[model samples]
Target: MRLKIKRSNEQRLITLPDGATVSDLLNEIGSASINIKVGFPPQTIDISDTSKLLTDSGIKNGEMIIVTDTIETEVPVNKNEVAIATVSNQNDAPYVQIDDIFLVLRKIPDDNSCFFNSVGYCIFGPDSIKYPDSQQELRQAVANVIRENNQGIYNSAILGGKSITEYSQWIQSSNSWGGAIEAQILAEYLDISIWTVDIESLQVYKFNDEMASRFCVIMYSGIHYDAMALKLDTSLDEEDSQICVFDKFSELGTLIEDNVLKLTNHLKNQGYYTNTSTFILQCQICLATLQGEKEANSHAKKTGHTNFGEVN
Candidate 1:
C-alpha cells in the first residue's frame, strides 16, 4: 500500500512503495540523506519525525504529511558521580583512586589483589587464603582449587588462604537477598577486609559533596548493584551502562568449580596441602567420639592459661 510518512525531527517528505515494512524503508534510507521533497519549511516532514505526527495526527494514505522539529536542551549528566563526565578540565580532572577502594565494587575477585591471590590457589580448603606469612604459596593453593574443581567463585571466597568458588556460587543463586549477605559471611569467617555496611546506617556528614553523590547511589542500591545509577536520567548515557564500573561489587556466585575434592586438589597444587584447622573445628562441633574436656585440659596445661574453662 502507498504510505505517507511524517517525522518529528529533521524536515523532509517521503513516500513508501506498496507492501513495504518499516524495516524495509529504514534499510533503503541508509543514512540521513535528502531523498524526496514533500512540503516547504513552513510544513517540512521526515520519516524520523514520525513520533510527533503519530502522537498528534495519525498517518493517512495519499495525504500531505507535516513534520516538526523540536529542539530539546540536553540534560547535563556530568555532574552525577554515577554518570560519566566529559573531559572539560584537562588539567584538574579528578582521577578515581581505585587502588584502595573495596566496598562497592562487584566482580570482587577480579579487581582486588586478595581476590587474585585467592583465585590462584582454588584447590585447598581455604582456596588461596592470604596469610601474613606466605602469599605466593597461598596463590598456588587457590590455583589448585580451580584445577581440581574446574570452576572458580565469581565473588570473593577466601578461607584462611584457600579459595572456595563453590561456596560463593551457593551464596549467589539460593539466597533471596542476593549474594552480599553470603559474601559478608565468608569475609567474616576469613577475617578478610571486605567491609560492607548498609546505606541506611551511613553518616552523610562524613562524606564530601562528590563522595556524597556517589555514596547516595550506592546506598540506594543496597550495595547490591555493581555500578550505581545516577539520580538524573541523562547520566545513564554518559558511560557504557554495562561496564560503568570495571571493579567487581555484585555478589556474583562461583563461576568455576563444583565439588570439594576438586577444590582440595587445587589447594594441594598451590602447596596448601591441608585444611586441618577447618577439619579440627568441624570435628570439635560434630564427632561424638571426641573428648572436648580432655582437649580443653590439654590446651590449658600446655599454655598455662585459663582460657579452656569455657570448654568444660
Candidate 2:
C-alpha cells in the first residue's frame, strides 16, 4: 500500500508492503521523533506505539498522513463542556442553549469572502431557501445597496476615501474584504441587527439601530470572519449542525449578550484570536514573514498574494 506523507506543506508518496507499522514507516522515512496523524479530522498515532499496524490503525492506502515535528491536537467544539439544554424551537430545529442562547465559533472558509459568507450564513440559516448559494451574490448585493439604496450616506466622505462608484466596484471584486460599512448596510438590508464579536478586544459592535425581529452574531478574528451559531453536535467526525438566525426577544437578547461574553472569554482562554496590530503574519505564497495586517496588506497588493497565516 502507498501512503501520501505530508510534512511542512510538502507531500511524498511511499509504498510499503501490507502490514507495515508506525515503526516501519518511521524507519522508512528515517525520522525518529515525529507526530503522525491521518484521516478526516485526523487521528493521532502514537509514535511510541510501534506494534500497531497501519491497516489496523485506520491509515488506509492512498490516504494522507501528516508528520510534524511538534505534536498537535484538534480543538474540540467542547459542546459538552458548555452547559447544555436541548429543546425544539417553533420551527422544530435542534439547538443547544446556554441561558436560552447558544453560539459556537464556526471556521469559515478563507476564500477572502469570509465576511460575506458569515453574514449569508446568519441571514438565512444554512438550510433556508432564502440563503444565497454563493458569497458572490452577497457581494453583489452589497455593491448594489451602496449604488442604489443609500447613495448619499455610503458616499466618498464615509467610504474610506473611495468614491461611491469605486467602492461599489471594489465590493464586487472577489478579493475585497468587508468591514463596518458593509455590515451596517447588510444588517439594514436584512432588517435584522448584527452583533460582530471582535475577539481581539472582546468588543461586540452592534449594527442596525432600528428595531428588528431577530439578530445574528459573527466573530472577527483579526483579518478573518467566522460565524457564531448554535452547535447541535460536538463530535468532530460529523460536520457541525448549527443554527445562526434567532428571534429578537428582550430576554433572549440579554441572554445572547451574556452568553457571548462567555463565548469570547472561552475563545480567549483557548488562544483562538489574533491581535491584528501585533500578530506576526506569513505570506503563504512566498513564505515571507510580515509584521502585522498593515505589512500583510502591503505584501498582498505588491505581490498579488492574498494567502496569509498567523505566525506564532
Q: Best candidate, TM-score-wise? A: 2
TM-score of each: 0.19, 0.60
> Cα lDDT of model 1 overall?
0.27
Clashing pairs in 2: none
Residue by residue across 247-275, what tens digits does model 1's lDDT show?
12221111011111232233234332222
- Candidate 2: stretches off by over 4 Å: 1-102, 127-133, 149-151, 232-242, 282-289, 297-309
In order, the Cα lDDT scores of the candidates are: 0.27, 0.68
Candidate 2 local lDDT, 161-199, one digit each (tens):
668887898888766788898888778767778889887
TM-score quality measure for candidate 1: 0.19
TM-score of candidate 2 relative to the true fold: 0.60
Error of 1 at 21 (Å): 23
